[model samples]
Target: MTIDRCHQVLTAIDKINQQDPNKININGEMIAKELIYGHQMTACLNKYWPTANEYLQIAVRAQHVKRWHIARSTYPEGKQGYLTWRKDLGKMHAELAKDVMLDCQYNNEEAEKTASIIRKEKLKRNQDSQILEDVACLVFLQHYFEPFAVKHNDEKVISILQKTWKKMSAQGHEIALSLQLPEHLAALVSKALS
Candidate 1:
């Protein structure tokens, strides 16, 4: 069944992500960072776009599948390096997700469809890809923004926020504005927007 295959693929992705050596503290408990990220992506998708198709759901959940495997330090320094690293990571995630889908018995077309979503092909032009991008932005705002802000100066943080904002949709902007961020972080977001 389609539902069963979807579950199988998701479970397989989770299994690989669980091997992440990095840990993050959530509510006083340490958890695998990427593993929690996958869950957060799913939570955001379910909350904002409950009727999302299985391919979108799988793409969102596998957005950062086994992300820690590629260390940012492995790439050259500066913006070009960062961009290259991100592009490579996207390809890696897509391939890994497609492999999982195929292993779960998904047809080649179905597997490629999900993989393309993971790669965020066509971004603004692809509805599913845009939704995945929105979910990722929302998750960053809700769970990761504050901590990230703390480590960077306001100017840098604002610049990063601006870049993140540019990648999101109007719907994503609305949801991001509705998040209950810490007061300082909220001020930074307002500053970034203004």
Candidate 2:
């Protein structure tokens, strides 16, 4: 019964993400990026932490639920604006996940757990939150980093990679090392690490 309820909640979260108007081209198919991103989060969690509990699983899946609704443009420009946007997004994601959990009949404790994970509370000190951060960083490295690198100067890209590396655990670093990044990108990552 608990497992069934969790599935229902995940389905509901996925359904909400499916309604996103913004789309990305994947494999010659136009699909909602957030929806695919949710799936990616789940996959990464399973790969990194196969024994993850239902709360962690659900938290990973809803990390970016309806993220596009809050446009980056709504915030000011520059580094401060970027930081502010990220902070607000974390809070918003937590609130949205809480509502979904409550709607799914999850108790307060369970809902709060999910919210904390979404908000990345106690990231380094909290094991579960750190796991989530690892998965998020891995996802960013695998899918978004290349495009992000193209837009930024090499120095900036290296700085971002170094920051991402710091967020991940040793296990995440091992997994990241195993990924087959493009030659140039791999060199940049190596440079950043060195």
The runs of at least 3 residues in candidate 1 whose Cα sits more than 4 Å from the true structure, single-residue gaps closed, are 27-29
* Candidate 1, residue 52: how far the Cα is off, in Å: 0.5
Q: List model 2 lDDT by residue over 1-194, tens digit each.
A: 88988998899989999998888898999898899999999998988799999988988999999899889999999999999999899898888988898988999889999899989999888888988999999999888999999999999999999999999888889999999999999999999999
Top-TM-score structure, candidate number: 1
TM-score of each: 0.97, 0.96
Off by over 4 Å in 2: none
Summing lDDT over every window of 10 consecutive residues in candidate 2, give the lowest-scoring window: 123-132
lDDT of 2: 0.91
In model 2, which residue pairs have backbone atoms overlapping below 3 Å?
none
lDDT per model vs. reference: 0.94, 0.91
- The TM-score between candidate 2 and the true structure equals 0.96
